[model samples]
Target chain A: MDEFSFINSIKQSTYKQSTLLKGVGDDAAVFRQSSKDIVTAVDTFVEGIHFSRKTMDPFHIGNRALAANISDMAAMGASPVFYLVSIVIPSHWTEDELSQIYRGMQSLAKQYKIDLIGGDTVSGNELTISITVIGYAACGKARYRSTAVEGDIVFVTGTLGDSIAGYHILMNPGQFINKNYYYRRHQMPDPRVAFALELEDLQRVALNDISDGIANEAAEIAEASGVSITINYQQIPTSDSFSQFTVNQQRNWPLFGGEDFELLGAVPKRDWPLVQQAAQRTQTMVTEIGYVDIGKELVYLQEENGRKPLNKKGYTHFKQVKL
Target chain B: MDEFSFINSIKQSTYKQSTLLKGVGDDAAVFRQSSKDIVTAVDTFVEGIHFSRKTMDPFHIGNRALAANISDMAAMGASPVFYLVSIVIPSHWTEDELSQIYRGMQSLAKQYKIDLIGGDTVSGNELTISITVIGYAACGKARYRSTAVEGDIVFVTGTLGDSIAGYHILMNPGQFINKNYYYRRHQMPDPRVAFALELEDLQRVALNDISDGIANEAAEIAEASGVSITINYQQIPTSDSFSQFTVNQQRNWPLFGGEDFELLGAVPKRDWPLVQQAAQRTQTMVTEIGYVDIGKELVYLQEENGRKPLNKKGYTHFKQVKL
Candidate 1:
């Protein structure tokens, strides 16, 4: 098999899908959507930088890249229609690994009903994966960070920092035996696509996905909306794996160590109950984290102390060390 | 510094001059063209698989990825408009390299009269770049690979294999002393945006760019249009680099090597004279390779052998070779 054969294997499958008007053979994938065709998101993952070749599996890397980008689409309250992927792999890789990566991507894409319209692959210095996801939303209804209200309640889906912990498990496999949950979190950070699609017309749900940890992403929403935020530390949801870490380590990881592809949202006070009910209808949890307020700074409610300024920051590529 | 700050520093100069409805801060970019609507194309480049860090500089890799995709719009005879780039850098890279890569992309974008709209940046293991370029073709005309006819004279812009030779030169920089031409070819393989825009109503002139070299791209156009192709080897435009290589090498490099981002087109035989005049007007040469025939084989006309079967296939990713 040759590189074109490998790329064509993917193209052949995606090109014939009914939803794609134009696919692998063309300059761009063209589609017709009922709602506004205004939203598109592109995300990239590099080997050694995003994943360790020594510890990470190619299948998981491919699945993770696709999932992370789709999560971005969900954050906008948009329904993803199609995607274009670009991959650069080291020339030395085997066909099996390449096929495994595609299989992983196909698995998630099937679940989301996302049509993999087109992508490019060529030889490069390292392995790289980039995916551009296009989604649709009703005009004027797509969510944005800039629209959060001063008195809105903040919500998050699932738990936080387990994906980071999964990385830890990969780095030190002997230390972790909770393979089922951590492995799932790292390989498949759920994109909340159905939830986003359902919330498109709700008007009060301002949404974003947690790519750069909860605190960092929340800070973006707060800054964009020109409002202060307050998080009750005790209320921040966590899974058992997350809770097992030392207090300072947990706080730091939860606050900064990103790559947590969870959905974070804000809703008006009046709509909170309705939003929760809506999630119940969809069979998903909507955990309340905190509230938005009219002020210049974010505050953390501590049990020992009344309140204190929270350092609202997340993973920095330039930072020297990790939590 | 935090992740947000890193993003802000990198976002400082990008899209500063763009008439972006919403730029990097938003979920997706919003832009309008004179045609009142838009068309988009997304292409991604992966490291170690598409290019070699040892052979290609970051600036050229960044610039060429953008330019090659823009050429896709050019093939549609579309005017360049706006682009969104998603870059995944290795975690170990420095700020200087990132800025330089963007600078290279921005420089090319400025020349093409397009805006750098919005993009997402993340740290990954291998470098991956995905760019979705949005451009406009007058409502009724966007050239496609599926439109070609018997007797249409095949035409190509610039020379083939120069970029390939340039890659070779870069991989072994010590081999050549007079590196000016090779260096330029490696860094900037011109996008025929102006030439493509000139050939309006591409129904009369089916077109595709030569990203995967002329032979492979021509085969694609032929296969898509259900037409047999014939190319005159003598008529294939060549550069000084062609003279340095063996005849077999010249043929192989021009036919199979990827990264030659030139334009491959088909125009009416009757318009041959006019095409020559237009080439002169644009100061870009248009070499007539061959024409469409009745059957399915892609043939080549050699000086001594007259018409002969062209059997060598172009570059394929599955070919077993060590990087």
Candidate 2:
């Protein structure tokens, strides 16, 4: 199919939100923003770099791409209203494969009540999907990574390390048994949007989503907030599926493996109880993994043996080196 | 550089507008919107397809990519507030080359007083730049392609065919003398944002950007508005550089060549004088080349002997065939 026909097919299955005034066919998409502030984030998923065709289905590829961006908005405690997706498809891919990708995106968009408003599709050597999500928040309420204060209690929502463990299982399917739980975690990460909104309403001090590993993201919050963070390695949350792995694998995965798409934030110690109540209201699991203190070093890990500096490293694009 | 350091480098050079509440380091960028409506457009430039590394500089590539999206917003008569760029670079490329590309984008963003808000950079097999521009317009002011009326005068901003001619010159540098003007036009087609805002203020019936050639765009306007548009072949605008080419080349290029990034719209004949006055105020050159009439044929070309059907074909990816 040609570009026009392909776009028409996409439009047929696209979900339109009430805020979208014009979509698809116009020179640009027009939408109305009713909130006091606009929240925007963009993430690009490259085949082979982010996922491999051999390991991932087209549906999962699309779902992961949009989920990555949605997670960013959730990190800011915003409700995503619309999103635009730009896909670069390889020549060998069939039209049916492309439609499947769009269907995958449509499914997630429907769940979030977000309108697929605009995008561009082009031919390229490798498949790459870039998604930009536009969201809304109340004025002065959107969470920021740079707002943590001394004595703030660091908290994380949901379990971690499942994504990386799932990725490994998908990479070597024969090596693991009953990998569906981990695989689904990797393929369809649930962005903590509703939970984050509850946190925002409770007025959290700082927030960030763990796209990178917990170590790297905590370091970011620490550096941005001009404070230091210390986390007890034993206190880190991990799923039952992840715990089934070897001890070393479980430890390394929660600390350094990225793409968890879980929320990490800080709340004043005095407000910790209220924060827990908010999490309960949202039915989100909350774990107190660390605390913020006045110091220069960004992050530290308190293990059973001793305390050590936490290296802020996760996935690096070009170096092809793991830390 | 790793992704963190690479992102830091971009943060140092990025220009932040006053409306931006947060940028870069946060999970998402936050910006305030004062306008009643938001306009968004996205365009992707693939290395070999939209350009070639051997012929075009990284600066021009970045400039062109952002310009394409800006032109889309301009077509809707929106004032661009900010833009996000997602770039996938080949591993063989150096850090300096990527920095140069960002600098190129910065230059244009500065020209329009828009912020480089948020984006993603990943490693891929080919250089691909996808830009999403966010603009704003007063409620009920943004123009649409589906609003043209019978007796509306179809108009085009500036001369056409220059971009394609310039592209030819760039492709074969030694074949043409005085190629700089055309080459620059091809590399950096000015997005008529200011002029389009003026036209919109004058309440033009319809508007479109000529990225897909005037013929195809006019046909789009006609199809969307359910009216017939007719243009005199002899009246088509061509720059002096374009006129230096052969008659057939000039004729065909103006009709079928794409990537002009010019504006095309329709003004009701009664408001034609007012629209021309608005263009004059904006110091924009506009040529009336056609009229919208009550018919179903979409588009027609008026030749010296007789009128003929104007085929709606332009640059279609994957088909390698030029209309």
Say which candidate scores most in TM-score.
2
True-vs-predicted CA distance for residue B248, candidate 1, Å: 7.2
TM-score of chain B of 1: 0.89
* DockQ of structure 1: 0.30
Q: What TM-score would candidate 2 get against the native?
A: 0.95
Cα deviation of B139, candidate 2, in Å: 1.5
For candidate 1, lDDT tens digit of each residue in B1-323?
Answer: 46556566546355533434455676555432333224467776666656677766778888888887888888767777777787776767776787777777878887876776567677655566778787666655667777778999998888887777887787766656447786677677788888777666334777888876676777777777888788888788877646777678787777766566778888778887776776777788788888987677464545556777666465555322111
lDDT of 2 at B121: 78
Candidates 1 onward: DockQ, in order: 0.30, 0.54
Candidate 2, residue A283: lDDT: 93
Report the error of model 2 at residue A144, Å.
Answer: 0.4
lDDT of 2 by residue, B1-323 (tens): 66667776667355557778887778888987755688987888888888876557888888888888899988998989888888888888898898889888988888998887888777788898888899988887888999999999989988888888887777766767568878888888899998887766575558999988888999989988999999988888888656578878878889878788988899889888877887799888889998999999478999999998899776575432111
Per-residue lDDT of model 2, residues A1-323, tens digit only: 77667777777355557777887778888887756799998888888888877667899999888998899889998999888888888889888898899888988988999987888778788998888899988888889989899999999989888888888888766767558878888888899998888766566568889988899899989988999999988889987656568888888888888888999999899999987888899899999999999999479999999988899766665432211
